[model samples]
Target: MPLALDVLAQVPTRREAVREEYLRRVIPQFTGHSIGEVQWSTAHGDFHWANLAGPDLLVLDWEDWGTAPVGFDAATLYIYALQAPKTAARVRRSLAHILDDPAARVAELLVCAQVLQAADRTSFYATLAEPVRCHLQTLASRSA
Candidate 1:
């Protein structure tokens, strides 16, 4: 995955997987922090289990792959891994370089907002709602 990301990171694109407009509209509603300058990079935008394959780390679904916040992929994977404690821990450990950075907070909140917004629309993320909310609270508090 690191190898793939390293290569993907080098591919240039004017596209933004997650636009500043979207972040401005959704993030502050949850974190109460205004979106400012963000560090952008190429990412697998939808880096979740469904988009990944076993033993060899084959990342599928390139439709959303493009420029995004630096930690977007890690944050998305981490948020989805929340229901499984072990997986969440592994995600944090493996991506500590990105996840531990204070700057990644915005990406985390951006993902949390997406999860919450999806929860509002359907039952797909109902089981994840509370966990995502709790995470949002944690992220918001950190910014305080």
Candidate 2:
């Protein structure tokens, strides 16, 4: 995932749901903005540990590359890291700039919704349920 803000400039977002319809049709309310209202940028459609090759710092899994909300890649990693709180914390700390961005919050919620939806297909993301709910509450509180 692209943690640095500069990484956004280095890549172009291919046309995909990350920037278009998912949030709107799938999740109507995210953070304080509608999906279409959020900011957009180039993103690795899928980003997880399995795709990363350390030492050399290579990234794999470019299957769903597209334009996504800014900081979404970081948000995706953070979501995937939920089962390992420490790793999630590390992701947050490493991508503080993106995670702290207003737009990133929406992206985070979108990922959360995605996880929740995935739970229906399989229990793989079940561990993230409570955390994602709590996160939504926090985000809602901030908006309120």
- Choose the strongest candidate by TM-score: 1
The number of clashing residue pairs in model 1 is 0
Model 1: CA > 4 A from native: 1-3
Q: Residue-wise lDDT of candidate 2 within 3-82, one digit each (tens)?
A: 33447435764567374566765565433334436787777767777877889768897777777777777888888887
For model 2, what is the C-alpha lDDT against the true structure? Answer: 0.72
Q: After superposition, how far is residue 30 of candidate 1 from its true place, in Å?
A: 3.6
Error of 2 at 120 (Å): 1.8
C-alpha local distance difference test of each model: 0.82, 0.72
CA lDDT, candidate 2, residue 72:
73
Tens digit per residue, CA lDDT, model 1, 1-144: 465665776779987798888998988775555767788888888988899997988989988888888788889999999988899989889888888877777788888888887886778577788888777777767777
TM-score for candidate 1, residues paired by index:
0.89
For candidate 2, the per-residue lDDT at 9 reads 32
